[model samples]
Target: MRAIAPQPLLDLANVSKMFGGVSALSDVSIRIPEGRIVGVIGPNGAGKTTLFNVVTGAFRASSGAVTFADEPITHWPSYRIARAGIARTFQNIRLFASMTVFEHLLVAQPHQGAGIRRFLPARRADPEAWRRAEEALAFFGLAAYRDRIAASLPYGIQRKVEMARALTARPRLLLLDEPVAGMNHDEAAELRTLLRQLQDRGLTILSIEHDMAFVMTLCEMLYVLDFGVLIAEGSPAEIRSNPVVIDAYLGSEA
Candidate 1:
């Protein structure tokens, strides 16, 4: 008999959430492998973002389990989850409008010193964090714009800065919600290449996106959600071919 491979880097087991009488997710389960980009796609109000929130601990699930690195972390707080090696971006860009691009990266740097004492910056300390921040700026091709105010940049650049801030966390699992939501085709393609580079550096990305073509190039696998249930799961080609997925998402195309 052949042996099965190891478990996924992240797993959701029978997970669910509800608001009043409405269930956002119902008994959903998914497994994400290491070093692979997974894309989530669905129509509006399909519980895509709700699933991300549940995994990142922005909200507690009404039932079921979420596991990272094989350890359960369903109810942990958002900050705790971040420290636990999970980091995420918003469906809408959320950045400190008044802060400079450099400051944004600095703030997301990991806390090196211990406790409250760490809050106060020493006259001289940890050059490592600063190095990482600068490296992040260059990684996103924003080293030239590092001094600019974040909000002052164009929308496309703001998106790049938002992603750079998330990278500053150096997360094991990067969750992106519509990172290319509002962009011209050229800009979106550029962002896709950046994400591919990040994944090549060993970032595990789980993204929610509407641009089917964009997702086709980025994701190694795809999961479809509709009315809070997982309707399909497969490679990009398989997802494109699945009739039910087409029916649920592309009505006439199905």
Candidate 2:
């Protein structure tokens, strides 16, 4: 018998997003198979973040559809999409100013049927939330910084905290934007290992990254976008040599 292919955890079918007269994503279609690490690469203004926004329901698509876990979620609200087991970290680290690493994880636990109250910090989180938060803390090796204010930590540490917080939500699909943006060589390498570990745990990840070295080595496959359009996609070896990709985005980097 022929081997079966994995189902996509997230699928974007000819999705497009428009703002007034400008188009941010133009008929972009991509599929993230279950338990894989996929990366999207493009230069600045390539609409990478816009893609994330549309998928996460920060912005509704002008046309086309998005499916997650076999459910149509193109029109779902941001919170609803999140509650449905999709979580994300921003390109810019968004950590609470006065909250510790552990506190950040506690507050990030997904809660349903709680609207505005969810935004308010909990005086005492439930035992399950504490367990998840603690697991994330240990997974990311952040136990030492658990009591330190998240924002007071170094930039790389803060990035880890953001990821840890996202994980505490217990997402099936995780979207990471510029995950290694400000990290040093060692920090990025360590993150690469951690991400692989997450994938081993059956998490599907879609990330937008400019760090070519990091993306090339870490992702199972890559998609290249230019001016809101997907230009190319393949294994790292294929992308590195594609003329269109090199000319359009990778340039000297490839």
TM-score against native, each model: 0.93, 0.91
Runs of candidate 2 exceeding 4 Å displacement: 1-6, 113-125, 252-254
List model 1 lDDT by residue over 113-216, tens digit each: 45564545621344677788888888888988988999899888888888889889789999999878888898888888888888989989999998888888
What lDDT, from 0 to 1, does candidate 1 have? 0.87
Model 2 residue 219 distance off true place after TM-score fit, in angstroms: 1.0
lDDT of 2 by residue, 127-236 (tens): 67878888889988999998999999988789889988888898999999999888889988988888888899999999999999999999989999999999999999
Evaluate model 2: give its TM-score. Answer: 0.91
Considering every candidate listed, which one attains the maximal TM-score? 1
The predictions' CA RMSDs to the true structure, in order, are 2.3, 3.1
